[model samples]
Target: MGNNHGSLKKEATQPQHSTTNNSKDEKKIDSRTEQSGKTLVDIPDDLMRKIIPYLGLIDRSNLAVTCRRFYEAEAKAGNSKNSEIWDSVGIDEKGKKVSMYKCFFEDVDDESGRYSIMRTKRMILSLKKTTPATTNAVIQRIFRATTATKMEKLEAAMQLNDCHSESQSEED
Candidate 1:
């Protein structure tokens, strides 16, 4: 009877200790959540709409692909200055469309540069008579030309047996 009483007392004490640990763990979790910065989902849609105008095409597309909320927010924000840019790009079989910037843009020097390019691309077509097809083809041509130049250099080097002397005349 004494042993049973002792065991009951231990079980009661064990639960108290476990409950204390659980409360500590919960506090830690709460502190961690506070320490973690706000995610995109945490931002209000109205605020996001205001911020969308400042984001470049790539950044906007990235946010759109992050989740459905961002995608909806972007579509409603009315910041899509160049709607035709999306038309030149095709949708995958899964009904997902890749961003034109990712497919066509070679390099973006910096955020400011990217923003300027985005602005130019948006405003240029309206001012000019060129169609999106023409613009896409021109961009693709530039990439092809760059690739061809690299291939030509590789071929020339291979033909030269990878040896190109910097100095034409040798001094003894």
Candidate 2:
């Protein structure tokens, strides 16, 4: 009976020891995984900035907010040169003209309007100089016509009359 009791005590103690060893092993593995994750920190700022232009507007915005370092890096890299970045400036898909400084200025308050206008004008000037003359003429005509007829609904309607509207009422 004494021998049996001693053997039982040994078996229970051995299992407890093994369990403690297993827990330690698990902790070591967890720590190693964490350290491996930290290894990604070695990526350079320039590479990260280069990658920012490919990201969507929301992703870029969130990433910019992540740290001031990232913001400066992105700005230095000219990530704002990416066309998608203009979405934050409130130029929607319909108004995405390289020449439309007004769209950019309209989105910001008066305090920032001058800067936005200057930046947009610079971007427009940087566009390819060889753009077709016909395209320029058409755009200029549209701009002049729109500005001249802005407050006159009938004139605006007359200007658009040549444009085909898909609505049945307009067709009639």
Candidate 3:
């Protein structure tokens, strides 16, 4: 009976192995587990963008921190919601001023996992200044200038027109 019990215990226990070999097996298992799933990167861009709007601000920030691709997708999501931003702009009944304040993430450093959320107070049309009488036209231009280059060009053209009009009034 004692011999039979000893044999049963031996069979129940795993055979002792070198620590080095055990560690190697553990590493292999770890790698397999790590490689098993489809990560966020596996998701298509259109699907990712679609997913972004459903997330709240903090959730968006968390998603942005994951990788560059996600960060860009989040930013693009913001851009695509231009109508929401436009609606948020405060415009009184009078065509005097249209103001839209925007905050967005920029300057993402993928390696260091550093990013910046920049807030801009845009005075699309100012109350004190004599802006376009047609608020619709001004709003259209504001929304259309999606890129920095486009915005800058729009600003330059507006400035040039202002200067020319001022000179014409002076001549009169």
Clash tally, candidates in order = 0, 0, 0
Our model 3 lands, by Cα RMSD against the true structure, at 20.0
Which ranges in model 2 have alpha carbons more than 4 Å from their true place? 1-35, 39-41, 78-172
Higher-TM-score candidate of 2 and 3: 3
Candidate 1 — which residues are off by over 4 angstroms? 1-37, 80-172
> What is the TM-score of each predicted model, taking all chains together?
0.31, 0.30, 0.33
Per-residue lDDT for 17-102 in model 3, tens only? 33464655555444544586444566678787788887765577687666556666676664334335444333333443333332
Question: Best candidate per TM-score, number?
Answer: 3
lDDT, each prediction: 0.41, 0.39, 0.43
Candidate 1, run of 10 with poorest lDDT: 1-10
Q: Given candidate 3, what's the lDDT at residue 103?
A: 30
Full ranking by lDDT: 3, 1, 2
Better of 1 and 2 by TM-score: 1
Ranking by TM-score: 3, 1, 2
Structure candidate 3, residue pairs in collision:
none
